[model samples]
Target: MLSALRLGQIDRYLLGQLLAGLVASTGGLVALIWLTQSLRFIDLVVNRGLSLAVFLQLTGLLIPSFVAVILPITTYVVVQFTYQRLASDRELTVMRAAGLSAYALSRPAMMLALISVVTCFVLDVWVVPSASAAFREEQFRIRNRMAAFMLQDGVFTQVSDDMTVYVRRRDSDGTLHGVMIDDARQKNAHATILARRGRFLPSTDAPRVLLLDGTRQEIDHQTGRLNILTFAQNVIELSSNKSTAQRFRDATEMSLGELLHPDPAVVTARDRPKFVVEAHRRLTAPLTAASFAMVALVAVLRGAFQRHGGLLRPFIAVLVVVGLLAVGLMIANLAARVPALIPLIWVHAIAPGMVCAWMLFVPELRLGRLSSLIPGAAA
Candidate 1:
């Protein structure tokens, strides 16, 4: 009972340290990535008149995707750092002198890694799909419905592929001054209109721009003919829905069941392979945490102890982990092209972990005695 209590205490302490490192590394990486990516959306908040709360909601929905990608890497870092610290402090040496096996030393880190694996699975299976769907829906709304309101004073904003709108100044009463509109949606006829002032008329469907004292210049593509019309007032129709009626739903947004047996009506025959590969990828991705943690543990604990730290083993451990992840990604890509390669994903994810576990544990035990238990070995 006393030995068990001591072991429990040690495990708790090591688990705490591992958790701390995992949180810190994952949070910092996620924050760095978010900062860089969110710069692309700054126009939405500053120029598009989107509220800060809405901006945060849009950005926050992406956290699950980031966490899913970073969890395995962070798990490896936590295990490597925690075991290296224990070794550096001679705690591992003391434990070994006390007759604690490498398996015992690895238990805490393994537990932590298992927790990370479970968390990653949850994110990959459910949270990621739901968040991705919500993000696509919200983004579609912003691009199609609220684009006109995003126009900034003194800046030309491309509302869509073939349309650009510019405004010099927007008055307090919502009147726009020095407005310019270019409409090239038609393949043959293109129009550029310059107006002294304009206001957005209230409409239920399409965007209506009421221009005052404007000159409309229409150019014919077939002939080098330009038709110019001077108007006192003109109302131009703008697209309210720039994107197609189809909502964007990628394989990443599908549930595991849906991805495995995708509806033929919803997913085309050519795209079925992509969905199947994604489902397999999600299933295999979480196992990388355990594989990575085992790699870190074996790197530190399996080798002979040195009075001075050696960089070779730790560097090799990092390379091994990187190779595993790279192989897994490459195999996933190939699996997307050829469904027969799907089994390789599991092999890439889990084989390293089994090998590392054997390297860490088998050397410490009497394999000769275990082999002697075989019926044919005695004969």
Candidate 2:
């Protein structure tokens, strides 16, 4: 009973270390990645005068996807590093001397691997998809419906490729003193308008401006004659041609069920394979964490211990993981092209872990069996 309790205490200590290392390493990498990724959206802050809070909120939605992508790799890294440290410190030797088997020593790492696998599943299946959709929707709103907010005093803002709006002065009350618009959205009937005053109207789909006491001037292409019309009030929509139409949903924004059973009208035959591949990718991707953990265990726990620590096995494990990542990418690409090959994604995700687990633990099990078969082995 005392020996069992001691073994449990050791397991807890090992598990605590693995958990702490995994969290610290994962967080640092995620922050670094977030900084680099957020650079792409710096224009919103520099050019559009977006607030820091809003900018962070807009970019923060991407965190879930980032975590999902890096969790498996980080799991492998943390496990490999922790076990290597243990071996170098001769703690693993002490555990082995205490009659702990390979499986017993690996229990904490396997537990951590299981935790990582569950986390990856939750992020990939639900959190990432929801966050991706929200991110795209927020981005769409910024580009289309927020054109009115982009306007500034004494500056000509290009609301769209063919439209420009200039405000002579803007008041604190959201009123424009003098407004001018150059509209060329129509190929044949390009119009320019001058307004005495204007105010932006709230809209969900596009930005709308209501002008008071405005004069519209346009030249007729057919007659080659310029026409001018004066009006008390006029409403003009400031939206790009793309914004006027419906936004198409990408694979990242879709739930697994939606990806698997997509609307035939919305999804083309060419895109069906891509959707299927994405669905399967999300399902199988989390499994790689367990496989990667096994690889790390095999690297540190398998083979004979040298009196002098050697880096060769750890280096080889790193190379093997890199090769596996490359192969996984290649398989995903190939499967996307050939739908029949989708099964390869599951095989790639699962086969490595199974092989590594067998390599690491089967010999120990064989030895136990042979010893049990011999007389007086139980004693």
Assess candidate 1 and give its lDDT: 0.84
Off by over 4 Å in 2: 42-49, 222-224, 369-379
For model 1, residues 209-286, the per-residue Cα lDDT tens digits are 899999989986678889999999999766523464577588888899999999999999988998999998898899
Clashes of each: 0, 0
Q: TM-score for all predictions?
A: 0.86, 0.91
Cα-based lDDT at residue 337, candidate 2 = 94
Q: Model 2 scores what on Cα lDDT?
A: 0.89
- Alpha-carbon RMSD of each model: 4.9, 3.1
The TM-score, computed over Cα atoms with residue i paired to residue i, of candidate 2 is 0.91
Candidate 1 segments whose C-alpha is farther than 4 A from its true place = 152-156, 167-169, 177-180, 188-198, 201-244, 367-379
